[model samples]
Target: MRSHLLNDTTAEQYRRSVTEGVERVAAKIAATERPFTGVTVDALAPRIDGIDLDQPLYDTTAVLDELEEVYFRDAIYFHHPRYLAHLNCPVVIPAVLGEAVLSAVNSSLDTWDQSAGGTLIERKLIDWTTARIGLGPAADGVFTSGGTQSNLQALLLAREEAKPGRDGLEGPASLARLRIFASEVSHFSVKKSAKLLGLGEDAVVSVPVDTDKRMQTLALARELERCVTAGLIPMAVVATAGTTDFGSIDPLPEIAELCERYGTWMHVDAAYGCGLLASVRHRDRIDGIERADSVTVDYHKSFFQPVSSSAVLVRDAATLRHATYHAEYLNPRRMVQERIPNQVDKSLQTTRRFDALKLWMTLRTMGADGIGRLFDEVCDLAAEGWRLLAADPRFDVVVEPSLSTLVFRCIPAAVTDPAEIDRANLYARKALFASGDAVVAGTKVGARQYLKFTLLNPETTTDDIAAVLDLIAGHAEQYLGESLDRAS
Candidate 1:
């Protein structure tokens, strides 16, 4: 057991163990034919539950052998090109190498002393990201767990800054009257943040969106005026850069103007569209992102990093004080005067993983353009997919993708009932997932069932999209035919 530790005494053991594990994973990747094995919860649960907690495998090889049967065999492989369900991207090789290195070193980024060079690395990455967004010289940010946490932190700052006379009403006493205006299609995290911050139940005002699925600036203006008239504190206006379902981006320049007039914090949830920042060709899609007071960026979603890499950036570095706290034992008050950089002072998290190293390694290994070109490829593929969906009579695509996602549903030629069509689309998605050839996602759009393809894998070609569409059509047609037979 002592030999298993990762210190200098067991360095050889660690090397051999890690190498063997990597080799096994490489072999598994080579052998995998599809994105998944279609293993059900019932089949996998018992196997996981049967493992005795007290029992130790003693040998790494034996554990690896067991993993092949219980874990790796049924694991959903996001790296596969056809695993087009959500925002998960096939990670880049350089970032994967960074994951390995950072895991071994195990640097905690909360305090500078704990992660000396790691802190600098993360800070530089944050600075680089702010520069890309054109957030100005005073911009600052801290890496977080993911987009949800980032959104929470951003809104938390907005809540704290809503003092009396700044946005109307008293500070903490007016919590119930504090309202956040956001587009109806905005991420659910905005509402969740409002609840977490102890705002009223009706704090989040859902403003309507335009035909493009973007936020309606006129409606937002009316809502802001209403809030002011009603004597409520309009603390924040969240503008989405990329909606989860439609990938629609709200009109940012207009929303920024509204935020200025209303004296409210402007937050842009660019969890998906942040990739466009790196995209040389598609950068204009999120043109007004710089106008946001604060922004959320998820590197894992589109930057091709691994899980647990995201950040919340604020234009005014002083705004980060809302999240700061000074403990005598850790980030002491005196340390602020010592000019020592402590990431925890601006982070919601206390003990944070060095997730930024992954991005740093990625940037150093392959310049930003390398990552940008890969993202460009995926966006191009999504455009091709959208075109294909438009020409095919079996599918009705929603709004054209502003990013790399297409939401559509299979429509049978003879089906008249909308409920039956919804069932067909739902069945098609589930059937495709069960067969293990491809995986897609389904969501409701204005009371109709629709399927979504989040194209993040550059390797996924137009033909792959065509093939998957045909599969969905076949499954839906089969379901509809079975329904007709039952009715007759």
Candidate 2:
């Protein structure tokens, strides 16, 4: 009689809480970024650890204060323009809001009852991505944790589809003799997926790359022929749309042709580059992606969404049936009669978050062209970086900027010894971090170490690159002189 469900929050209460929290975070982010001093974490660690951390453990306000402290102060703000490390970048406002809303609802997408509207929303998103990728109207796919899981799911299906008489074979042994072909520049996930699928990493044939870093189509064809002649089942061809090390896009049209000729499943891992589909200029780069048996796309990468928003898109909806398993309670015998395509049947996970909402909201708010333009802007910035380095004799740009990645080494004309040059570049990155000049990622290509920059933040400009270059050059001079002095 005394309002038994008072504890249950009303919609108005939920809305106000979300609105207040978002406004506060937005103001904090804006205010926090006001000072543009270029110092890295290594320089600030001593000062950062001096902050207080105790009192009012039971109070909600205190808890929120603590959350803000950890979130703002200690956290390496990826949204900061200087954060060019790895592939992490600034997520957009709309997507961030979507993340907040979804987190508040805490919807579990595992079953329809658990998330009725969310299930439909995610399905619609999958359908939209599928059609955009040129899969026929009947194609289907599901969200995964990231590109790694998407790659794994694609390969799992490939193994099942490729196995001779696998439709009836019930054991792992039946999947033997299955092989996959990918480029040396391909992400390590393919090798990991092979090992996890029981096919062994040896099963993934490493194809050679051309001067441009693209997977050699001719080499792939030869490997496929050899695989057939050897009587091994050609399971799948994993073509990379944007490789991790160089951001090189493989020749998809030629690869797709081979897949057709040899009847092998073609899975395109466009994890970093699939967003190019939105751009009029770069869309033609992935000309034959339409023919892929499956595709992997990371919304978190190019869509400006928060993490854990990745997908595996299959050419045919029926291929997902290969991963089907039935449970009585969740996917009941009686419910099967209703013909609700249980997403759980196609996924590798049982408990899934409503990740598609973030992407869905982003696309709805900005439209496909807006997202495409964002990709174009970043790619243009990368091209600008490439041009900047190409004109500078002090630097050695290893590869042409691909998509949003810039790979170059800080080797001035004064340095001759390869060993010493390598040492200079290594210390320069550390010095850059130590000095808080900029946050940059480094990788080795062949025999030399090169600093890499991934430009996913649309707000970043050529001026940012100029500042980082200035820092790198300054650090290089200091490091190189010390190396020479030490040797002398």
Candidate 3:
């Protein structure tokens, strides 16, 4: 049993195994030739099914070799320059070091005894972020799993604030009358949160968006007025700091003013655009974020940190008490009276990871200005990509991007029909992915299917964007030709 523990006798073996494993992984990441290997479910499923879980390989090297064959060989490489799909960012090196350190220690951040200084580290990071958002002195926040969890927790707090005394009521009639206002383009989590909170889907009222995909403030104002007129409660206004598909930010100042007038809780889902907090030149893009009652920020999405790094920040610290349940075995009343910081009090989770260490180490090593510069680079690349698409006659570029996402569709000269163009673009996206030449995203803009480029890699340049665009065009043309031949 003592041999199982990492003591003086086993330390050398443990160190060798861990070091070799890390080096192998780093080598693979460094040697990856493409952003994706186009490994399909049908191909990988058989290999995965062949694994014998009950049989343990005594040799660590043999286990690692099997891992390489089954997992690492075809894993999607977000660090690759051509990987332009989704909101995944290439992580910073310091954050990777933080992950290694935190994982080895296995610190649980739920209580002071469980985490000790880990609790302070997370709280310090939260305080630093809240200061950047200008949430004032009373602001507090807790690290969450990701943006979805953060959004759910934010809405939970909003619900508690909206109706303080209706927790154990008979029927959810009051909850049914409560409405959440958000843009038509906002994240799906808002409606999901409502459902989980017993407000039902109908409680979510979708406000219309403008041409740029940002929320229309006038429409929101009118909707709030209508809610008031109907004797309905406008519980919260959910604003999108950066929408998923288009990366469009709503008019936060105007929306915040409307929320203030209507006495509604304001929650901004800034998961994709939270990097604006560190942005040096373009911080003004998220100008009114400071006015939000609560904001969800995903460091993984835009801060170039690993996954599970995000937080839900509240403007007033007292609002976090809504999530507190004094467990006798955990954070008891006496502990609170003694002013010990138990993070479990504010978080939706009891067993939480010290995810804040990643961001803290990243900020300390890379500096906030450096992170901002990296984000600016990607935004600049998107602007350049927009110009390239706008000039090309084959592609129909959407509105100018407010952030690092470009949503557009293919409309080659060969495809005259609207439905045919949609099919062609969809086919091109799928073909491109299957070929593994590039990884791009796709979404539906109204009724038409559009391809998207979500650039989060600072290393990617205009030439790389042009190459991917050319590939997209070639795929679209090939698809159209194939269709024509089939018709003939």
Measured by TM-score, the strongest candidate is: 1
Comparing 2 and 3 on TM-score, the stronger one: 3
The sequence of per-residue lDDT tens digits that candidate 1 reaches over residues 1-488 is 57677898999888899999999989988898999988889989999899886998988899999898899999999888889999999898889899999999999999999999999999999999999999999999999999999999999999888864554455556699889999998999999999999998899999999888999999999999999898888899999998999899999999999999989999999999999889979999898899998999999998999997999999999999999999989999999999999999999999999999999999999989888888889888988999999999999999888988999999999988999999999999999999999999989899999999999999898988999999999999999889889989
354-424: candidate 3 lDDT, tens digit per residue: 88889989999989999999998899889999999999997898889999999998889856799989989
Candidate 2 worst ten-residue window by lDDT? 1-10
- Model 2 reaches what TM-score against the true structure? 0.91
Query: Which parts of model 1 have CA positions greater than 4 angstroms off?
Result: 164-173
The Cα error of candidate 2 at residue 71, in Å, is 4.0
Candidate of highest lDDT: 1
TM-score of each: 0.98, 0.91, 0.98
RMSD of each: 1.1, 3.5, 1.6
Candidate 1 local lDDT, residue 233: 81
The local distance difference test score of model 2 is 0.83
lDDT of 2 by residue, 303-412 (tens): 77899799999998888877777798888756668977567888999889899999988888999898898888888889998999899887888788668898888876
> What is the Cα-based TM-score of model 1?
0.98
Residue 411, model 1: lDDT of: 90
